[model samples]
Target: MDSSSEITFDGEQRIGIQKRSVRRRFQALLEELTVMNVQSVADRMAELNPIEGRSHFCEAVMRSQMQFPQSTNVYAALVAAINPRFPDVGYLVAKRAAVRFREACDSRDRDRTETAAALVAHLANQAVVHAALAWDVLMYLLTVYPMDNTAAAAGFCIECGSMLRASAPQRFTDIVGGFRRLLRGLVVDKPLRRRILKLIQADESMFEDYPAIIYELDLVEAGEQVTHMVSLLQPIDPEYSLDSSISSTSEIAGGGYGSDEEVSSC
Candidate 1:
């Protein structure tokens, strides 16, 4: 094995079968960050320039607010599913979700009572706060790694068969493919398929100000975006990814790391 090749989670799921890998990753992160004070993490997140999928995350938050409009289970499920591998992303998504949810509140608006204005403002502030915490978490980890070294990431541990929070996914063409496949698998409802597709394709992450484009589309039209984006995200099949799976991808034997309490709340 290469010196950098380390054991990470195997794919055996503990909670929901689909969630097992990410759950492991999430637990480790909370443990590691306990010492880092979440407030600092939030500050750093604000300075971040949005990444490729950020706009999508932001839009998803808004759509969740608009669509679900009331239930938080979807929000929690999303956070639970994503926070493991993409904690920063999850935090940002949370912040965005809060604002979107508030915006969707029929009782509140800029023109409404001062109480509504204050409430909306408060949620917006909280969004920024969460974003900062998430950012700090990422930056702190980045500092832990040697400036020139990439192998220091907690990365994946095959022994546990779970993804760990210590590192980000390495560059692989297939990562994009895998993400698309995962998103596709998440779609069951006909409406969800369209939203997922639009999210993948014309979303602002894919194209600037794409949200404007989305508002123009009817639900049926939006569904096509999912398929289009999947093709673009993975122009070729992910056959190569499976065959050339990252060296870090190994199966686990048993126990490792933190309590389930912090991670399981989702």
Candidate 2:
């Protein structure tokens, strides 16, 4: 063959080899992701280098969802691996899943709705501690799921709020604002409203500037109840003062009261 033709042939051969190698590696990763054992999948994920494995992790998760559309366990494992390293990718996967859930809800598919709720719940549980991503997922749920699922959506918001209060109080205002905007006109159930109130009460200082917002939502009584509850929970001392400086010091030192507890109680 002429030199020019030989060079072109070599280039084609190199490209072909590269494609095959990528496909093989992807298949291997897929095997690790799809194994019957959840711990095995988690172990393999732990061993992966985040910087190098990010794309592979994304592809594996997307493919896993396609392969096991009904398996919340698989989605949870995949999300748990990706969220800490590539939360944006995790959010994208979650968004797609949410869209699917919305479609199922719109179609009145009971079985599909249940499965979708489970998948979204797993994603929310994995991402709730992450403020930005959690808000995105929570908004998606509130927008997509019907009022029938309002309690679940409210539960997620409470969890997200609790996490933000404990770990990222600085971001609390923005996250709470997002929740307020999304939940403003919706008729939230009494239990859900109570849960939201508890979240606000857990870190009242975070929402101090927005008391009017809470009041306008008809949550004033709930807020008062929380204040009373907190007062009752406090250790009574005649010498103790509710001074701002001491409160600030305590907040700064402990990172916010009840932040270390699980979200269920928050």
Candidate 3:
């Protein structure tokens, strides 16, 4: 509360209050954007136009198909909503949030691929497993098909528009399953295959009560990481390439999968 409200100063007091409210509103929007309902939004769009093999997730990713189009206007709105009265908390949060969010998504994709690769070992034919792994990666980086960025989400969107996309699908489970199918087509590594089972059956809440109980959660648990990351990415190194396997799954091979630059317009 500014002292202006108590004194008969210019309406600066009311203006300052409005700015505080605006900052709070902006922060809330970011949180909402983080929980973006990609599937629902895509479904709504499909009602008007259908895209085969492309889910809301894929469609949303496609906006990054040529760089995210600031698909969601949250960033811009936040900027415009900033109160001239108070410090720019909205700008500060937005600038850094985008960077960290991008890192989390990129790390999630890598872990998915690495886990897929490892599952291939458990399969029967090593070659087939490789192909399956490739497909999974293809699906993830599908928006920019043939443009591999497993080590990175290169052209992927890292802007405020990304908030418009849905939460990450459990593509990792599919990737792991696909790899299993590929290897199974070959010979079947009943023994090596055990690791795949261990991972699938393992606890997903590895970051929960007891991380050691990896046998509880499923593969999508990997995606759940973004939620944890939203809070922590700001403090940690966005490029740190966390390889603990327990958290990010893949080593910070390089940088994020996409760039906010791709969707600056949106």
Candidate 4:
């Protein structure tokens, strides 16, 4: 090959290597952060500034959160810590989560629905997203799948009841009251009713050990926190395209190191 062609080929190879290395770092860091305590998770997550690989970072966190449901709070905490500096990460996570929740509900998959619901609940608690999204999910569950989603609604209430209540007392009261009314009806099984009631009553203590946003990790101030308004009812584009390799039209120049390629979100 010509000298110029050889030099170009070598440069392309080096760029490809750097991108892969960054992607691996993103994946590994996310996995480690998910299992750590909230405090430690926060401490570690603050080090990340994935402006170039922002979309890849989102993909890693979402994948980890879904695979390990118990670590949902940790993931939310990490997002909360980095959100103020990297608003795109928070926005993408919220959009994907809303989309996931909607898909799970439509397919009648309780497990998936609850998983997505939990992530959204914790995110709301961290103020990464608005509480209205949670209200929409609750209303949808109660109004559309009243019988089918009783358990999901109960779980959502228990997960972030404190935050929801603190944010809007009247709405929180109405939501819980609505659920209680359904339980009193004859249609719901006695055992299920009893179980849900216990969960609802215990809502206050749900976050005692793993609080939604650790005070130390609460990086975003009330005014500075960018709460993305993602409605479950709106036309949500999950930006799944962002998860894949950037095509030529969208590829970042110079191995995608510094450019913040703007990806459209819901």
Candidate 5:
């Protein structure tokens, strides 16, 4: 081959190898980090040069959360902690979560639905996603599929009720009141009925010492917080391909964290 062509080929090969290496490191870091050591984990994740292979990082995190529902809060905390620096990762996570929640609801997979809802609620509490998306999920479950999915709605409230209430007290009151009105005529199981009532009438503080956005996880400030307005009712692009492959041309921005311009959508 000509000298220029040979150099170009060698450079492309190096870039591809570098991307694969970054992807592997991100997956390993995610597996090692747990809720127990989230603070240090967040710091390590930030050091991973995330802008390179960010899509891969996001996919790994989402898959991890899907596989281990019990660690939902840990994943939420990680995202919140990373968001201050790499805001695009936060937006991608939120968009993928909205799509996951919708698919779970459509499939009537109660467990997956609740897991996705929990992720969305916590992300909302962290201000990684707009609160409206969380409210839409709550309203959709209670209003459209109350008989089958009251538990998911109640679970979401339990996960982030205080934040939702704090964001818009009147809207919180209206939605929960409407939920109660709907429950009046329907016959729900005793356990679910009681849980729903507690969510509606009781102070969320009584149930959990730490709010949804735990103090340790509140890494983004009010001005620095970037709320991605992804709605469950809207036609969302999950960017499923992001989960399938890493970009060969991924570049680490010099500024680091919030270095990239605002990514409006996935």
Candidate 6:
């Protein structure tokens, strides 16, 4: 072969080898990541207590999520695995998924919205039913994504009420009262409203011991009075007192029962 042809052939061979090498390295990285099972990582994180350990766990999960954004199963497994032990981590995953869902909704991107919604729903469903953190995620999704046909608002309310019933007596008043007040503010459809009323009726046993006057009153008035009674039980924080009930619930639910700044500091 001529010197010029030999040189060209060698260059092409070298280029092919470089491309193959890059492909192999990419495949190796993907394999390593996939082998790092999300459930196992979550289990390990549960055993960890220190802030550093929690941070590292979060970082690892977040890194995996970034690498496999399309892997809804991984996200679902991570949420389910972490929730029973570390509810805060579960909330974090749900919150991230919700953010993505919101972005898709804003852009009117149906496919992306469906993907994000599936992830969010999986996390919500996997959450421990009576956990305050789980309720928070469920409630937040109901509030923000209400217009979506697949948002499952009624089902979420039923789940929330069931969880609230199972909660401690002291917490029942706060959670139910807060939830009622939240409902009064939303412009929900008739069917949704009726479903909520049915849930409240099912929990009537909770308030059976209250004064007869409460029962005589209409649902709205009764709910307001109940909320007032519970509000008295909570220590009056001047700062929180000024905020509306919906705002307070949103802050607590979205930020792990604390302000965003407070949760982030931890």
Please name the candidate that would achieve the greatest lDDT relative to the true structure: 5
lDDT of 5 by residue, 138-174 (tens): 8878766667788878778878888888878888778
lDDT-best of 1 and 5 = 5
- The TM-scores of all predictions, comma-separated, are 0.22, 0.37, 0.20, 0.77, 0.79, 0.33
CA lDDT for candidate 2:
0.45
Candidate 3 C-alpha lDDT tens digits along 1-266: 77766645345544334333332332223334322342233223233322111121221232322242222232222222221111122223222333433343456554333333222211101111122322332344434322233222211111100111212235444544554564567554464345444433432332132231123111223222111112221243322221121123111323322332433232
Q: List the pairs of residues colliding in candidate 4.
A: none
Query: Where in model 6 is the C-alpha error above 4 Å?
Result: 1-39, 46-70, 128-266
Q: Please, what is the whole-model Cα lDDT of each candidate in the order they appear?
A: 0.29, 0.45, 0.29, 0.71, 0.74, 0.41
Tens digit of per-residue lDDT, candidate 6, span 122-184? 343333221443444344445555465223443343434444445445655564465466478
Per-residue lDDT of 87-153 in model 1, one digit per residue for the tens? 4554454444333323323333312222222222222222222222222222232343322111111
Candidate 2 to truth, TM? 0.37
User: 3 or 5: which has the higher TM-score?
Assistant: 5
lDDT by residue for model 2 over 1-266, one digit each (tens)? Answer: 77766533355445344433433354465555442454454445545543333433444454455445545445564555545545544544555555555566667664555455555554544441233444444555556654555455555444335444544565656655554654576776677677556655644654343221122112112222110110111232221132232233333322432221111100
What's model 2's lDDT at 171?
A: 61
Pitting candidate 1 against candidate 6, the one with the higher lDDT is 6
Per-residue lDDT of 40 in model 5: 77
Better of 3 and 6 by lDDT: 6
Model 4: lowest-lDDT 10 consecutive positions: 257-266
Per-model RMSD to reference:
22.8, 20.9, 19.2, 6.3, 7.5, 18.0
* Runs with alpha carbons beyond 4 Å of true place in candidate 1: 1-51, 98-107, 110-266
TM-score-best of 1 and 5: 5
Query: How does model 3 score by TM-score?
Result: 0.20
Q: How many backbone clashes does candidate 5 have?
A: 2
